[model samples]
Target chain A: MTANDYEIREYLPGDEESIVRCFNDVFTDGDDRFVGRDVESWRWSFTDNPAGWRVYVAVCDGRVVAQCAAQPLRMIVEGAEATFAQGVDSMTHPAHRRGLKRPGLFVNTANAFFDRYGGADRDVVHFGLPIEQAFKMGTTFLKYEVVRTQTVLGLAPVVPPDTWPAEVERLGAFDEQVRWLYDRCSGAFGASAIRDATFLEWRFSRPGATYVRLGVRDEQGILRGLAVYRRTHLVVDDVGCVCEWLVPPEEPEVAELLERGLRRLAHEDGATGLALVVPDWSPWFAWMQERGWRVHPSVYTMCSRHWVRRLTPLWLRNHWWYTLADTDLV
Target chain B: MNGRNEPQQESASAHGYALRSYESGDEAAVLETFNRVFAAIDPTFEPRDLRTWRWLFEGNPSGRRLWLAVTPEGRIVAQCAGIAQRMLIDGEPTFVSQSIDSMADPTFTQGLKRPGAFVRTCLGYWDAYSGSGPDRDAFVWGWPVETAWRIGKSQLKYEVVRTQGLLFATERTFAAGPAPGIDVAEVASFDEDVRELFDRVAPTSRCIAVRDAPQLTWRFLERPGFTYRIATARRAGRLVGLAVFRDGSFEGVPCGALCEWLIDPDVPEAGHALAHWAFACTLEAGRDELVVVLPDSRPWWMLMQSIGFRVRPTKYFPVARYFSKRHHPRWLWDHWYYTLADTDLV
Candidate 1:
């Protein structure tokens, strides 16, 4: 279809099913990377998000032809929490193919989405870990500036600390202590996703995925650190995917104890090593390297569009503490 | 045309401290501030002597430009300096500035309300040396440590270019050794052979420093305290590859790094052969692995990975400010062919 034939507008309450169909058509047709998105997961990602959602779709003959969507997030920016959004589930139907003239439906839909909800008044920053092609499009048309290239650090199974100083316990649910530890941990970063227990509950409640939570408690039985991991064989071959490993940099002993427990946890799953996603600026990136972890460039490069002057990419480049859990995919 | 103005000279005076371009006799004061500032931050920092300082700054071939914040009594309180680089961007002679030793003594900044002596001194240097003009640098760049990076990003408009990372190969699998008709040998000095080799490789690079014989000799061969191993790879008697290595330690673990590598991309085998040699030599020298830094967009990135080199993020985040619209941050990052030799740290 030509650009004139399609109508692009903000997401409506009932547009979820058609958008998911178009997304699945564009993604699951031949690409091994996607398994075809379901409407329930789409709801859980955007519609059910506590912060909010901003999505736009291209309508052709009453069926969704293309879509651009973002999952709203409440992030701990500086010291206070602010609303942000992560660009996710962007796709266009192949049946329409190229518009063959002017700006196409996909680009128009994306532009409409950004115009509707981008900037400080809406979502302060629109950020994502886009694939290379999407990143090029975002930078070329959507004014997306690169934040940094991400790397996944891998650590081989290692011997745990002989005498663990803290009690390592599996967390069946995130409690008030997780919020306290998250607040304390996020203080070290200029910007980070709000990791309150509510976020953890919604984040790890993936329908089919089992998220393993390990908490480190000090001698007083107060939670000092928390780690969340899961096995995603499709993601990186039998390696445990670490979403969050939060302990203050000053609490190295607690981090060490948490790591020891996580290593044993991952080893129990018959994994070769544990793979964690962390940004370059995170102190843990260097910490992992110092501990003999092997780091490799991940397939995704982080890009962001800053609307508020407060969170420029330059400031975020040196300060943003991000991990796999910050992303919608994880 | 898009970058900020970099005037030939910049001066600022405030609260009993004056910032100006380095004069001949100001060397001692500047050197003292540099050593003292660095030593305070790093306990193991080796104090640079006058000879080494002169060789690094004054003896540079392109030229020397250092700005120092000095008291009225001529004691230097802060300094911002750059080791000039003669680079070839898109096959044109381009003057770039590589900032080094940006330091300020706490004693000088203690009573200052805001924008202390260190920031002021660096501003003078940056204003006079960077941005767009016939005499100005195409860009000013540096690998500032984490603390300095924060200040630079916030105040000096230093955009993040790329976070520097190294290609480390811990286990060599005896692959892609010297091919037939290819020979590798250590060279005592760079000469016409190295110059011609660079001439052949220059056209293929979007951005690269002019690493001719004299430049190589100045950087790796004649540099004062470090003994660097310069190796050449010859294919059927013509120089096709050049590599330099410095035996050093990373985080107290004995390791060697391939500091510089230049070879034609068409002859990927030459690079592979040179890498194999470097890896073997590093292991032989009692180092566990060979580490290197190269832009992942360069042709050699995949080749290095194929041979065994794995990527690891470094402590450095490469930052730069560009003068021309033709040269954006990503443009420099994706095309620049640089290694550790491009930096002063190695």
Candidate 2:
């Protein structure tokens, strides 16, 4: 089929079945990032998010061939609440990979998605944590800029530090204390996704995703630190990923206590070690290095396309309290 | 053109402005545009004087470079200036530049498109001064606060050397550690002997400003509307170390800053003695904290951290555009030893 045969348009109500088929066909069968895609998981990401979808598709006579879209995010920009978009599910079927002689179906569909959603009025900026080649193309053709090189800190399993009591327990759901904890922790960032109970409740409730929520409590049984973990063989190795790590930078003792408990859990889950993400500039980076956690280069690079003038490249780079939980990859 | 030998002019129609090199009489116009632009955006900006402007742009002994963007009405709306310094990079003498007074008036550039007049002005400046050439600077850089940095990397090819970290002493008082036998003395001006001290310390860094007598005089001594307490540490009548301090405010908060600190690598005690003196002087000034920036990967970081200081990264990335392999950013990152005085922002 020629590029003229493909029609690029927005996502309709019944596009999930063909979109999943297109995704499975586009991605390698046993790829680490995309082991597989099912209709149920696809719907959970696209339609079930509270912030809604920003999807676009290329249709050739009712057959999906390429798709590009984002899962909307509610973020606080320099203390003022705003909505942001995280670009995801970027795929193109093998048969129509190059578009032969013109701008491809994937490019057309991706442009349609960005044209619909990329702006300050819509989501401030449309960003993604894409691999290197995608980042280069996005920067060259689509006006994307590097935000940060994701830095992941890793340490092998060890006995818990005995200086403080590691009394963390499994939490069933995020509560009011988690919201308060987020409020106290957000001051350390220039910008970040809103980690309130409303967002977390919807974020962690994805289908077929298993996560262990752990929290450390105070004498009054108030949650002081929280960590969301999953022991999986990631792109790197078998490790307990700290999918979400939330605690005040000022309270290193509380962070250590929670970390001690996670190490125990990670060891019990047969994980090789615990891997956590902390920006290289953060005080927590030094804390982790002091505790013998070495920084490993990550495959994902954070990039963004700015539609807002005020949210300049440096403003976003310096301010954002970004973490793995902000992206759909985790 | 004015027909009276005005600065060399080049057509810059991309933003409805003309670009030109600096001439002798352009100081007042440049200063006016700088003060006006900064006053509009930064409330804490202190108005600059013509004498300081003349001394800043014209007084550089190594070299001076300036460019301005002017309207058809002869209004100087934007400027790209560099106060150049001589340095020994990769075993050869070379010139490096630090940008000061990078400005673009909002009134003149309100609705200009992306890669606006200000960004284009900077690009024009870089093309003339940086990259491979016999007379080109090793690299030109600026400690852009935010707007400049944003417009720079997105438009101009700015590669960040590092997101510099600041070390702040928790308490303003001196530690109870034993004082070294080095004799610390306050100096009225940097004498010719200071050059010798800098030469001894130059080998420790790969790309460093040759901080000799001329640079120090223009940097700290001759600067207008500011005073830095310059202290020198001597061992057996030999200059072993130096430190400069200022009582200042940032964002209207009363603060103290250690502007410059350099000690001989072989004489670690001299660094301790200087640090102790800085702490005691700041304590006498009743400051809450003493802030300074140093590469955290350096030996000085461990020395300062041991003196009850904590390091936190600042958003200020000292970005650069290089011309030669001698001043590559990788070499600069690991071996560029600089202090607050090196940048014009402070």
What lDDT does candidate 1 reach at residue B197? 82
TM-scores for candidates 1 onward, in order = 0.64, 0.67
Standalone chain B TM-score for every prediction: 0.92, 0.89
- For model 2, state the Cα shift of residue A322 in Å: 4.1
TM-score of 2: 0.67
- Residue-level error in angstroms, candidate 2, position A81: 8.3
Please provide, for model 2 over A186-220, each residue's C-alpha lDDT reduced to its tens digit, 9 standing for 90 to 100. 88787788887877877788777778888888899
* The 10-residue segment with the lowest total lDDT in model 2 chain A: A157-166
lDDT of candidate 2? 0.75
Q: What overall lDDT goes with each candidate model? A: 0.77, 0.75
lDDT for B96 (candidate 1): 82
